[model samples]
Target: MVESESTTKVNVLMVGTGEYTTGYVGGGAADSDKGAGVVALTMFDLRRRNKVSRVGMCGVNGKKFAGIRSHMQKNIGDVYNDMDLTCETFPEDTVVDPLAYEVAAKAFYPGDVAIIFTPDDTHFAIAMNCIQRGMHVMVTKPIVQTLADHQKLAALAHENNVLVGVEVHKRLDPFYADARDRARSNLGDFQYMYAYMSQPKHQLETFKAWAGKSSDISYYLNSHHVDWSEWTLAGMARPVRVTATGSSGVAQSRSMNTEDSITLTVQWENLNDQKTLGCAVYTSSWAAPKSDVHSQQRFFYMGSSGEINVDQAHRGCTVATDAAGFASVNPLFMKYTPTNGMFSGQGSYGVRSFENFIDACCAVNAGTAQPRDFDDGSLATVHTTMQGTAILEAGRMSLDMDGRPMDIQYDGNDHEPIAIVPHVFTG
Candidate 1:
């Protein structure tokens, strides 16, 4: 609890940088490890933003980081020098050595926080250490794989009084924040919503690696759509039942173990036990023009007065009347291109997410921060897992997941006709 007259500061510790292998499909091949991208961006942001002072990075090792450490260690602005947050240096902070995680937890002060930039599987262990040591944590998405694990993590975060938030970029993005605000405003009564996701084939490879053979395509991709729908559509309808139809034509065609195309059919029961507007989503890894795909994300809301389309891929959107007339304009797009600006500097996923978490922790540490918390993360993830599992089963024509029917919502309701059956849906 050290406080100076002018300002107070909180240090951040990070863990699990050991160059990892994500257990990919087709005999588990090796691919690029995640997290470094965010670290590199954070260093650059610190050098440019001049807000935070320094970060204590841990979990890096002697071998994998050997190639890039020299450059990063000198650049990332550690405390070795009088380098405050504004001044920049070279060679990133790998925090290598034997037993870095334990060493990191031991070093964090009460007013300091820790960020975990590792995989989903390592969340509990690394978080447990950080929380026990009186440090807050900002973890990446999908912290835990199953419901049981979610329960444990939630308990730990609260019991420790340490703030824990999962990285869901849209939650923090002004783009989404504005849309959410409007949805609650004159957008009339919020009925149902739809979220669409279309990414490149490589995303599947990335998924198989992190998720392993047992993990399905639906789990990684559709989970995003499902979770967001629950969030935007006012608390996930509690999903009475979910039915899906998927395709492995592209995945199998590529010799991957998961499906490539999946359309989710969700049935949600409104208050008083009656099902209302159905929210259906379709995710495709096989969209036309792979070169131009995944450039953005989009959403649509069905309100009584009018509708809103958050055309995320194109940067922003245009709300129009059903008569196809321009209603109004709200231009909220990224000025920078994905190839450079957003993903590179200004708005990279890892950097933005990591920064938000750190700021949240720093606040709490200084008696001022507000993390999104663990329960929020748990709910989103559980909703995702459940929805994704149902989608995968619908693809395989199975009603079971781990020896169960995978409870979800599915009903035959579509104004424009939704493909509830893959055989019938595809054709």
Candidate 2:
């Protein structure tokens, strides 16, 4: 008799302890959308369902674990029945160690998994540590700041034979999934795409530490839409040049030397027909005023045959309260409300993203699947997501180089980016 892959329970270690991992930042629950968080809560519930085991969480400051545990106890455990939120903390409760993630990674076995939700600049180092240890990794968006680092991680993951996935949950959204499918099927050759995503200005304070110094709004927010656009036009079209512009008054006023908003215009050349080209504009900002929704996200796609529009933020759902006032909610991304007193958000695309990675890790561990099997554009693996990184790095370079256009050079075979250089005018 053979052991079933379904019966293989993989252990998980969550890296970083900010809002996305624990919903506890600066000693209390975050003021943003992920109050109960998406990562730890899902891990806790997955443990309850026996899908995973021995879940642990790691962060830079070990003292914050007390507050994080209390926050989870109140928001997640108290709300859902049979929810067990038990996990080991790294660097001991009394010690503060910046490199605690390495210690946590060492504790996990080779076949275990690690999900990284740290700041944008720290992703490559932490992910590299885990991958070298033979642990599968699922990193949050903007996987790395530079195309060079992105390529290095991809190469290392292949060398180590570990599954690596980028946590682009938007790819799992039902509406976005349908849109991608329709664009690939019904829509003709890609022509143009415009995408906008923004968060309220208050978020700047939440990320004040590294908002401008370590990263910018483009890498933090624009990565979402850029990846979607890349995923939509994969194999059919590839980005050739990128030009960017930014707005800077708001963040500078707050003493942060960063842009408040950024826009990137990318030129895409059709793979089959070099004569045909498409244009894409992606803009992101953290300076939006308070609105009914926390994040305002929408996109428009125009192809040779037809067009499609999506306003993902406002899905026609509104709620009014004297305490919080009238607001539009998106339960499709994450349904935090409990059903019958047990965790019922298993169907959420946000939840599905984590589950998909875990299942892939388990399958690989059971010898039923290989890491390369997920590179077929289904999961946002490192190999499939390099284009997004190229565009993002190019956008950053353009912003720094006085809005100069950057050129993306590809390998000509797989269409993956090989180098990014300034678009020098020869004529």
Candidate 3:
């Protein structure tokens, strides 16, 4: 017999306290788009709905909890009725521990859930720890910086019998989801795709601690479209090569040794027809001037039978205020506004992303579903997203090697990536 949702509610552990997790950066509430955050807010609401129980958050610096709680209280708790801001924080307030997440993970039992939103470099270790403990995990995009780590996580998740999802929220966007379906059903063979996403220059300040030191802009931004393209062309085509180029000066001027803009050009081969090929260009930057929206995201897709164009940043919705001036808003991604003294953004794609993961975890815990059950491409499981990781790592390698093209080699029959090698020249 299957257990009821109320009885099998999964406990959640959030593994980061940065901008995306809490919207509490540096000191107070983020001034950018995510004033209240996506993860914690969604988790709080999930708790309210009885989908989850006992929420906990872990971060390297324990001292930030006081400010984080205050920020959440003001932005989330105080604004929404019955919204609980209660969470167990890792590390004592006076102590700082880089490995505090390990301690936090021990507090939960097997089949619990963890959502990671940390730096690119820390994803592997943190996720590995969680999965090893038999906990389900949902990692932020660009899951890891290397293909080897990605494959390792996939193997370990299977070994531990846990579900591991990559939090590519764009896949849940209504427009993007519809486009993917149309491209798969109506559009013919893949041909070309162009994606551009950028954040304002101020983001460099928020990310200065690890801008180029830990990861680059392509891994930060391009991962979104790369994963989308991979999902869109799954089984239809596979990425063959990646060559990257980057421009600097803005970040350098800001005393950061990182590129201001980066572009990755990838070549894809149709699975059914090897002779036919497709190309995709993904560009990302953090040097964009301040605009009506926090990020400028748009993509163009072409196939043999049809084409698609999407401008996600501008959804034909704009708002003007005395203090904030003019701005374009996307309530579809996250509607932070309250309705009837309650949180009403449950229909948002961002909220759905977390809710979906929680539901999967609960199902697994209830013995109604297995971890591998989610690998059917419905969710961003570790198995289905290997190609995206390969492309992202290859792009980073190309940029580090002065723009040399890298070939993505896959194993026979399995279609899993085996190696990423430099392109060989022949006369």
Candidate 4:
């Protein structure tokens, strides 16, 4: 810890006040576990532990701040002891400006942090501005839509000597982590992998704006497994080609102008042997029926010697209630229930992900850690997730070209790797 009192806590500026941050989705607080949202609640709890300094929030619509604050006060602050839901809001809560984040982002200095939970398309511009001003940033998944933008952000972050991370919290899952370790050790050469992740159809409304216009379901849900796959097999294999197919009519029927589901078949070249190859199928959708679990996630991996199977959705824990009906709960992600009337979610991976970033920021500010320190395949650093972006964008191009195969080209190998243009569809 820093001995100087002035440099003790890192200031934070939250860039979004929507579902993931406020849980006030579609006008009112969501009835799900995230009634008060994940990012805001975790930051508030971090401040209580003296890890964060000033906390501020920003949104495009200023009128919603009142409802957001009221919702949070009831769902979060009022529930936890001495939990204050007070923070600065950009645009003065009177002006409705789309560029309010630009104003809120100016309050933090170099070494401070900005946790961006905004839409996918807006991430590049906002994150660029923050990095230019020398502020550490942590953005939501599918960091950016294009590989060009991802590489640009990585370069800018490195030039500014700032920490930029993607919030891929699945790495914090013990089961997933164990699987990754085993894959590296016991699971011989990569052979085949199949992964699936989906959420209820209602999430379409949650992401209505950018559902089809800005990005697609592959970029939205498939990013988790793609990153997980890459993270698990980073040094063992590299993705070479990808062919994508999608099922439509469902989302188009709903007037969303997007695909109902997408499947990407990626070809991998094992690093050890030039001729040996591996294949992976990654499927994602936001149009599944409401099951006992809020999301259905599972994966099966096979190697030259052994194989592994993981069903992340069913954890052998189920609960039924009069109002909410029956559902399977996964408290490992976010333990919402308070202990002793105070926020006690330290063990949860969702909260731990934020805490890890905050602690890294503190360490960096204390002159004990460098940006490359986190590139050790632990956290989802910008550099480590470039290939995932490549695969997702390649899938998009494949869809635009009627399921044609696309190639993922890399400029360099592991040392300072640069992603070449993806989506080279020629069918």
Q: How accurate is candidate 2 locally (lDDT)?
A: 0.91
User: Lowest summed-lDDT stretch of 10 residues in model 2?
Assistant: 1-10
Listed in order, each prediction's TM-score against the native is 0.64, 0.97, 0.98, 0.95
> How do the residues 98-148 of candidate 2 rate in per-residue lDDT, one tens digit apiece?
899999998888878999999999999999999988888999999999999
- Stretches of candidate 4 exceeding 4 Å from the true structure: 1-6, 31-33, 415-427
Q: List the candidate 1 regions with Cα displacement exceeding 4 Å.
A: 1-7, 16-36, 47-51, 58-62, 70-103, 188-191, 204-208, 214-216, 235-238, 253-255, 271-277, 282-289, 293-296, 316-353, 369-405, 408-427
- Assess each prediction's global lDDT (C-alpha) against the native: 0.48, 0.91, 0.92, 0.85
* Local accuracy of candidate 3 as per-residue lDDT tens digits, 1-427: 2222243698899999999999999998777889999999999999999899989999999999999999999999899999888899998787799999999999987888899999999999999999988888999998999999999999999898889999999999999999999999998999999999999999999999899999999999999999999898888888999999999999999899999999999999888745589899999999999999999999999999999999999999999999999999999999998999899999999999999999998888878899889987789999899999999999999998999999999876456787899999789
Candidate 3 TM-score to native: 0.98
RMSD of 3: 1.9
Between 3 and 4, whose lDDT is larger?
Answer: 3
Clashes of each: 23, 0, 0, 0
Q: lDDT of candidate 3? A: 0.92
Candidate 2's TM-score: 0.97
Clashes of 2: 0
Ranking by lDDT: 3, 2, 4, 1
Q: Model 4: per-residue lDDT, tens digit, 1-427?
A: 2132235678889998888898998789764556768999999988888998788998898888888888898889788997877799987777899898888876667788899988888999999998888888999998998989999999998898788999999999988888998999998999999999997888888788889999889998999999898899888888878899998886887799998899999998888846599999999998998888878999999999899998888878788999889988888888887898877878999999999999988887787888878999868999888889888888888888887788777655652335534454358
**Weakest lDDT window of 10 consecutive positions for candidate 3:** 1-10
- Model 2: how far residue 47 lies from native, Å: 0.6
Q: Rank the candidates by TM-score, best first.
A: 3, 2, 4, 1
